[model samples]
Target: MRETLLLLSGFVLLSSSTNLDVLLHQSVPYSPQSASTEQAWIASLESTHTETKAQTTSTVEGERVHGSMTREMKRQYEIAAYRRTKAQARSTPTATPSPRVATLNPIFDKQDIEPEHRVIADQAFRIIPGHCQAFLKNFYVRYDNPQHRGLGGKSTIILTGSVPDEEFRALFFHELGHLTDLGCFQGTAVAGSTPYMDKDEQIWKDDPSVSFYQISWMNSQAHNRGTTEEDFVSGYASWDMFEDFAESFVYYVLHREVFARRAAENDALAAKYQWFQEHLPDLPKVAKSNTRWDGAIPWDITKLSYDWKPPTELVARR
Candidate 1:
């Protein structure tokens, strides 16, 4: 019986030793420093980062890539924005577009026809639809909210912001874009605002990566900026149709006009059309002419000489 007990004890000892070895050799790290495990994990992280950067670089490469990307994004944003405004218009349950054309209050409807003629006939003649009225945003009063009285009324679409006098007509063309977007003549209200700035390629190269996600992403990079008017600086870039249309309209206005200015200090503006042409692919050649963004109204290079004309009779204030 003593011998049997000794054999049994030996067997138990053997089993315990085997179990200890198994645990020590388990699948997880057994090394003293675990240096290999850490190295493998780091390698994985580096690979992932490299892949992501490569993807970013690949996405933004092509001919006129910058302009193409900007235009495509702006169009995408415009579609979505219009939808939002459509919803708002429906939600408000306001007045409908008159089936028949109605006369506008001259001051409210619009008093200045000269600017319209300039933008259409001289400036950005390529973009101006025939019989374009820098129509008033009169109907928008129902839905218009006083958010940013940056320069004018909540719905009041002013002709120019803080730009020089010579540029007001072109600038007015930009505001006209806001007017057009706000159902100025379409008789339909815009659903939302979409701000898209397409800076020159050289300009973008300095900062790099103006991704739409910077504006549209759930946690947009545009949301976090260092500025006193952070909301305007960040959200403004993506929020308002007024900005997008205005900027695009501005391109139509002063695109080659900048060249005209340089013609005095540098090369002829006409010669620079080729450079501008490289920027806009969708537009026609004639649309690219340097004179297109000019006007019948003589431009005062210093400041706006708009003599305060008496408000037109049609301009009946509500």
Candidate 2:
């Protein structure tokens, strides 16, 4: 049976034979304006925090007494403390301050996910770069065969059913690649219409992804002038520029040495690899000792396994 791939702006039905491993639900075009607004909000929070700290210190000093209080004094102290607590609560924001300027925490709707699976999902989410993490807004766990291996879009990621931890992690990383492409790096907005149609090179010109897209794709459906599969990271990457980006992203992260070695042989592959290095210089890479450059390319790169670092706290960044 064929399944429909849901996009934020519209839906496109895919044949059963189509690789549905990674699907995107397009979200709002990311803009610097949003980041600036978040920066302003953060500054306000810092100011409020400073004021609250001073107020709390003063309150503590005032409340100190050498002797036991009488009934009247006790009642007044209780009221004052109650009022102070209320005031502080009102002033303080619920969201914790992050070191990064405009990063947002991914909200996990874990009601559908098994406890053990949720743990694995959390670990996978932490492995991606902080800039990509900022693009995620919601995460969901679901069970839908032939439809939901993994879906990312609308600032959300949805994982289908349970699988081995490593496989789950790899799948999540691929979905994150989608989020990173759509969210962190956005195309220019076309007037009076959506900007995500893969065929439109004009919208993509401002994006770093354009360089990668130009290497293998003239548009979304055609190859760039003379490029071919030899220039792509995997068979799956040949599907389109978006898939090319996501697949290349996963390869670069999970099998850096392998990707580099492959790049040495092909000029197109080398350009793609260099793009990642120049754009995401600080992205975490799987240790070289843990990866091997088997000349054979997996049709689905996300299914491969490499030594992944233990989960650490996710740091937010712009």
Candidate 3:
């Protein structure tokens, strides 16, 4: 039995097919909504809605104070004034919750992770049935060749007895990407249907010079000496959209420094800067103002990684 090195929590360990043991424990909670509080919330919502309508009427009437303005022009003026006033009112501003950074939980080495991560993990799990807090299965994915320990099949994820919280979360997200591909977590891509599986091989072939064997402009020792760019990069990229998706998510949420670096080099990253300007929730007004684009993603058309950008709309969302 070959012991493959795996990372769990932040600790590294060696394990093999025969010795790997996965504990099955999910930390899902059933925090049902309270009815009395819900009713109060509904009442509050109704009051706010009523006030909004009343304010709209008052603003419209106030605009009529100037008869010469056309209806559209008057509406624009009111909107602009309302926004200016609102902006001023919010001058002192409010602190926003930071984007949750996925951290390595040391307790996983001791098998003591709290339910907080499990809760977030479920969001990705909710995309797939028969998948819960974390899942494991020994099956091959298109990105990977068949291995003694892998993920595939109808149910359960395989764990090697020692899954650290952060690594576990990474693997959970990694597998979740596969689940996402299955239309389980994110899409309705029928198994073996989407054409994305071969995207990297196609891209690396198109640009063997830059991608094939470059050292991590970020890391000095990433590339092996004398490794041909075509072989190294082509193999490194490995039609693995799973890794791409995971890398993209990690860069977006945690390694934003890398995101910034990529955006500078690749036009696709620039497009993502613009795209994220429009989509990322909870950004400060200042950062929102910094994006130079409005309608399209800022990255270059060819180099933009799909994981870095949101999917283009295929059908009108009705």
* TM-score of every candidate relative to the true structure: 0.25, 0.61, 0.28
Each prediction's RMSD to truth: 34.7, 11.7, 19.5
Q: Which structure among the candidates has the greatest lDDT?
A: 2
Q: Is candidate 2 or candidate 3 better by TM-score?
A: 2
How well is each residue in 147-243 modelled by candidate 2, as lDDT tens digits? 3366665275656555676767667777777777767776655432223353322445566666677777766567867776678878777776677
lDDT of 1 by residue, 83-182 (tens): 8778888899676664333443343332223333322223232244434444332211111222211111112332222233344444344444444333
Candidate order (lDDT): 2, 3, 1
Better of 1 and 2 by TM-score: 2
In terms of lDDT, the poorest run of 10 residues in model 2 is: 31-40
lDDT of each: 0.29, 0.60, 0.31
Error of 3 at 227 (Å): 16
Cα lDDT tens digits, model 3, 1-318, are 012123243222233222224211111111111101101112343344443332243344344443355567667767878887887888967777444434332212122223544443433333233432243332111112112222321132333213434444444444443333222232223322322222222212222112211222211223344433222111222223333333333334433444565567555444444443443333222101122322333221112222222112211110
**Candidate 1 whole-model C-alpha lDDT, 0 to 1:** 0.29
TM-score of 1: 0.25
Candidates by TM-score, descending order? 2, 3, 1
Residue 217 displacement in candidate 1 (angstroms): 7.3
